[model samples]
Target: MLLLIAFEAAKSGLWPAISSALFGQRWGDNVVKGSVSALKNGPLCVLLNFPNLALPLMFVGIAAMRRLLGGPLAWAVGLMTAMYFLFAVRYSVSDQFMFFVPFYAMAAILAGLGFVRLSEAGKRRWLGVAAIILLAATPVTYSLLPSITQRFNIAVPGRTDLAYRDSPRYWLVPWKNNEDSAGMFARTAMEQVPPGSIVILDSTTFYAVDMIRRLEFSDKDVRLVILGKDSKMDAIPVGTPNVYLDSAGEGYHEKWMDEFATYDRPAGKALFLVVWKGR
Candidate 1:
């Protein structure tokens, strides 16, 4: 259903804005990378992270369930397990963990049954199995311990092997996931314009700033025009007041690019709102 909506939006020229709002620019901006690098870094990152423990445990759980559970439950678990593996192996991003949530839950059910099965075995065998489980969990425990301690206001020595520090996956963090002065750019952009000014922003900054205006600042009078193939400055009257919110050197449409005095923001910044009186 969502895919259909996206297809229709693409047909109507709204997918760019819709995609920006849904996934943020990391995915939308790098559509090429998302497509081409689908099999790249995700699996390795999953292996390094504690979450990967569930993968092996899930298999064991499924095997255990095959005997203990009904055919339907086993089938469901098997289906989810297959889906999880495919998602994990296909794309290598941190938020991809979201797709693993249901798989992990089903896997946990299997692991629980497996544990019960182990307990029903002889005492020594149960102990051995329990030790192995703990060993499997050791890396995750070590990884989470510092954050857990810090959250509880306990002082603990910093662990150096944290996934964010140790893994290449850290670089794939989403663009919108990081800290920013909340709504600063949006607020500044709105403040730069007169109360009734129409804001013209390149596609990159358009959705983000417009979202901020609607949610945080609540500036109802400021109209937003997102610049893309389907939308351009030509729609606006030539002499109307407008502001261009985008980073410099984005190669914005030549019509607006040639007219506005460039407001070059610091290199690597995400937004530069250039106030314009007319062409």
Candidate 2:
């Protein structure tokens, strides 16, 4: 359904703006990495990737239901359904229910359980038939869904940055996901930043890139700063040795980059890596 909506938004030429709103420059503006890492490491990632693997999971869910959820198929169904929804709260908080992928995965898991329980060979055969039919109909249905009428809307504009900067969900986090998230921001700065200058990220991808990729940041000149939950200064990160993350403000105020580089931030560094050789 996310793909469906994204495709529809893109087809209608609202995608870039929607992307900006969803996770691009707007909401993601606070984040540094692409979340490529966050999506890989933790529970938030588990749910992020859940939709992609939903198909085969259906079969697995049904088999597990029959085999594990008590003796009978009905009992298994009840258990799996109840348990998944209960567990899904974790996923929901991470994803903030901004998209539909998680819900779809849970639905597929239940369907798979039902397909597995049909003992009649004919019933099993019909299940296979239904699966094929639904698979085939998906594109048709996607094609028929309405075009995007409105672009993405940021529910909480302040929380738009990546999870690292604000940790708005920190109260619910199982542990320190912010460390990696903060590193991700640093890594993103190292990427687009020219050597020996500061870099600023306006998207979440800044804090979400791969770690191996971090070494690519070998040039020491790059220094990046993710915005705090609140902006105490009217500033920006642009030009050589200076980067900016200012969607909420404009008409930049200049500050000596070196002044901020030394400040300590528990979330992470307050400025860029501060050592690199720009091209």
Candidate 3:
């Protein structure tokens, strides 16, 4: 039943999402363009974009080692890792990579199983092998340093570079990416906008906005209209109060901006809050 609902939503939602010029055309264009790029660059290129090249091999190694040395539990972890790759390879969008969390968990399970087996194999003599693997893998994490990591694109030669070459963040320290800023923006929106106003936003900004509401921001009275997915300005009921909150970016809605009144101008290139005229 749930699958049926999900399928129906996809079928019905494509056009509405596309007409909004956010998800529909953008997604299709990306898939089409990425498909061509992937083919030209070959398998490694595609894998690099999705799992950063080393990860898929690590996943495969874990699965294979588990199958040879461990029992059913370890084997299952391997199988799950393989399964995730099967799906991920087909729809490997970087932004949508969060869907592969289960795959990562399974890979971790396999790694843990390997460590246990290594400990047992040589009666504690082979324990150092596991420690060595850990040491080798530690640097890969640093390879994700946004500065150097961002430049490590194997698909494009000369673009590849060491992960720590120019990175400022110290190795292995958790870096600030999304959590703090998203929360701040959500709070700002709730505090500035009146209750019960319609807050229209693009798909990306909508997630943070909705997340803040769901978590403790607590301004539940407002309605969120995800632009490019929901109806445009004409759909709002007469006399209804409405606000449009969009993050500043390539897809700035000029028509909406020209029509609406700027309610609150927040600092940074992250987001903007606007309201419909006379509301």
Give the winner by TM-score: 1
User: Residue 239: error of model 3 in Å?
Assistant: 13
Runs of candidate 2 with Cα error greater than 4 angstroms are: 1-77, 89-110, 116-126, 139-197, 200-203, 208-217, 225-243, 246-279
Q: Compared with the true structure, what per-residue lDDT tens digits does model 1 show for residues 124-206?
A: 47556656787677666555644655578653211222212322222223233443433555666665566776566665456
TM-score of 2: 0.35
> Could you arrange the candidates by lDDT from highest to lowest?
1, 3, 2
Question: Residue-wise lDDT of candidate 3 within 1-279, one digit each (tens)?
Answer: 224435656877745533322223445555434454333433433343334223443544574574556677556555556655443433425433443455666555555555554445563453565455756665565455445544673223221112112223422223545325446666677666667776767654578778887786564687777776553556664345545455433354435555445544554323455544676
> What's each prediction's clash count?
1, 40, 1
| Root-mean-square deviation of Cα positions for candidate 1 versus the true structure, in angstroms | 10.7
Error of 1 at 181 (Å): 5.2
lDDT of 2 by residue, 203-274 (tens): 444344323235665445444444452223444332233443422222121234444433222233333233
Which stretch of 10 consecutive residues in model 3 shows the poorest summed lDDT? Answer: 158-167
State each model's CA lDDT, in order.
0.53, 0.42, 0.50
Which regions of candidate 1 deviate over 4 angstroms? 1-36, 44-53, 87-97, 121-185, 188-221, 226-230, 233-243, 246-263, 267-270, 273-279
Identify the superior model by TM-score, candidate 1 or candidate 2: 1
Looking at candidate 2, the ten consecutive residues that score lowest on lDDT are: 148-157
**Candidate 1 local accuracy as lDDT?**
0.53
lDDT of 1 at 228: 60
Number of the top candidate by lDDT? 1
